[model samples]
Target: MKLAYWMYAGPAHIGTLRIASSFKNVHAIMHAPLGDDYFNVMRSMLSRERNFTPVTTSVVDRNVLARGSQEKVVDNITRKDAEEHPDLIVLTPTCTSSILQEDLHNFVERAQLEAKSDVMLADVNHYRFNELQAADRTLHQIVQYYIEKARKKGELPEGKTEKPSVNIIGTSTLGFHNQHDCTELKRLMADLGIEVNTIIPEGASVSELKKMPRAWFNLVPYRELGLMAAVYLQEQFGTPYIDITPMGVVETARCIRKIQQVINEQGADVDYEDFINEQTLHVSQAAWFSRSIDCQNLTGKKAVVFGDNTHAAAVTKILAREMGIHVVWAGTYCKYDADWFREQVSEYCDEVLITDDHGEIGDAIARVEPSAIFGTQMERHVGKRLDIPCGVIASPIHVQNFPIGYKPFLGYEGTNQITDLIYNSFTLGMEDHLLEIFGGHDTKEVITKGISADSDLNWTKDGQAELNKIPGFVRGKVKRNTEKFARDRGFKEINAEVLYAAKEAVGA
Candidate 1:
């Protein structure tokens, strides 16, 4: 395996932990090294979860490796079951533990005999799968395990609720705007005279999951996490599932109509056209904003989108079809879903890239030179380096992405949030001219700090003067690019000719 300074997704065990922690009364016991327990810290910090993360790490140090890990694993499992008394306990292994090839399934069997709680070993190959894939598989495994148990006991709910209801699947802990999206989805469903039957994994119990098939239909918004379970439910229970992620006006309307059609097919009445019209005309301002004069600046502006499958495709379609922005390229790091993502976005993007490597994504951004970038936190850093504006649209994000305010990215309200993000992400025409001519306060500070920094590569008076002539907003990027160029070419000092040559060579 190749080494990378940054990764788009974590190892397989993180996905398992995300699924386990998303549900109430569900605990995860990971047989891993000490350093591998950072998922708890990351979830606590990023998600701002007040309660303790429901995961226990069975530390597998050198001593444990020397002595077989089965005892420690069983001990931790039984202890968590006794103390937490969780309804379900998921046993997993980290990449390091997976290398040892221990009999984790046997450990689970041993623990199950002693523990009162239901113990299930997560079937995931750490070497073969990443976080998203592992999470999807783990969630499906958990659902199947519980649903089959319910079936054996003859406890599975048989009929749908009196009112049209849907189970919102695939929302879990640490997901990008999942809580807000669920809230928006509930609002949309209520507006359409539908009730939410159950929301899986996030705040739902194992018992609730058993009753998931009772809903008239299922809504799987995220492509990465919930589609597997939805597909299984459809195959087993003959329940239809809608996997549409309603991010833009057109898609939201389509999702509403799809939901309406499914409900009406199930013998429920729904006036979808009127509801759609009311939402478009009153509830959502995105349609109005797109047609307004304020959006003229973005009509033909170029943009690049790179994120997870759902957000990447959704944002690309919104920028291309709704706002009339030109999406130069659209891509996702979810290589497993690359074909589907490409098909979803082929009409909107000029090119589609599917790789987790930040280097390739950065290179694509530099080559295209899009005015705005809608990507992850990694792309935010890339944008800062290239002096391009970036709006983070997906996960692998910082704490700032999880805001306390009601910023949903799912229904009619989400359209407003997305449009605002797009409008603010681009450098408007008049604002750019003004900033270039009379530098803003932050721009002046950045330029001064960049020029005054003490670096090994010396800049001659002529080179410094030439660099100062660049626009303040992009002055730091130019300086950094020129310095990199000079350093690569073995130049001790940068003069006016060197600056010009570096500018041309690096396209700063």
Candidate 2:
């Protein structure tokens, strides 16, 4: 594992906790040390969740380790059962606890016999999977288990609804605008004469999960999170699933037609052209904006995108194919999905990056010098350092990412939002040249000589005149660095010699 101060993802157990925390009436029982409970702080702080996150830590303190005792795990399970009375309780272990070689699954199964609730022991092999993979696997296992149970109970519905229905899978607590994505998807499906049977893993009850197979098909928007569950339902129960994430305008239109075609095969007639008319294009500004003269400002502008596989590929495609921006570099931290991401971005990017190291990504950004950046919050810092504007399109997000408005990065609304964000982020038209040409003449006093130099260090008239020769784009940076250097070195005022020395010192 990389020993970095920051990481793109948490450990595997945190992923399992995300699945357990997302749904209603489900609790997670974690076997870990006391410090491992810090995951709760992350959820509470980042999501600002009003209610307590549904997770109980079976604290394995030094005392328990010294005595080799595991009675605390059973006690915690019993306590959670008595207190929460959850319909489902998931059991998992942290990386440190995994080394104990304790049979966590067997223990949870036995505990279920004594408790009133059902328990699922998520057997996540930390050696093999990361956060997103673990989440996908755990959710899939729970979905299959509940589907099987419902089948045995004779609760599986026979015959489909009059209108075709689809279940939306893979929306979790920390997913990218998950609630808004679901809302947009429901709106789109409702417009197409299709019914939404249920949305899973977020605010879904165990009963809702059990009824997922009743839908005519499944819509797995996120490949990293819900594709496995959708594929399993299709293969095992013969329910069809459509794997497409409606990101940009073109992709969103394609996804709508694909869904229509799939349902049309099941005998529901749909005219895709009728839906993809001027009305649909009007729903997203990007469609018209791409052909407008304002878009000419973005022509040949380069962008570097780095994030999860889904957003990275989608943004790369939209930047190049839709908004007329050039994608000079595209990459992701999701290693498992690298091959698929590489294939998807082949037309835009010559090479695809697949790693979790922030330093490497920062270096890549420096090399590319993109006009705009689309990535996680870490990349935002890198862009700011390089004086490039960054629009966050993926996870490892900050509180600022969770906007209160209906900003989505999916469907028609998402295409609109993405295009607007890109337009606002990059330098438009000849603004930089205008600033450089007219910087020094109009703004004096404050702009040129607002503050008097100190007595000991003075700016000679020639040095001041020489500083004005620099372009406005770089003058501010040079001035700040020179001033900071003089302040640090006990210089009262800057002279010509000191100014040149400071310039050389700061690599200006």
Off by over 4 Å in 2: 1-4, 428-508
Consecutive 10-residue window with the lowest summed lDDT within model 2: 445-454
The collision pairs in model 1 are none
Whole-model Cα lDDT of every candidate shown, in order = 0.87, 0.80
RMSD of 1: 3.6
Candidate 2: give the clashing pairs. Answer: 457-493, 458-494
Error of 1 at 426 (Å): 0.4
What is the Cα root-mean-square deviation between model 2 and the actual structure? 6.3
Model 1 regions lying over 4 Å from their true place: 1-4, 428-459, 474-508
Q: Model 1 over residues 1-508: C-alpha lDDT tens digits?
A: 5333788888899899999999988898888898888887788889987785458889989899788998988999999988989998999999888989988889999999999999999999899899999999999999999999999999988887888889999988889999899999888888888889999889999988888888999999999999999999999998999999998999999998899889899998777898789889998999999999989867998899999999999999999999999999998989987899989999998988999988789878876767889999999888766668899999886898899999999999999999999998895323644766765534433332222234678889888888877765466556777777888989999899998998788664
> Residue 49's C-alpha lDDT in candidate 2?
63
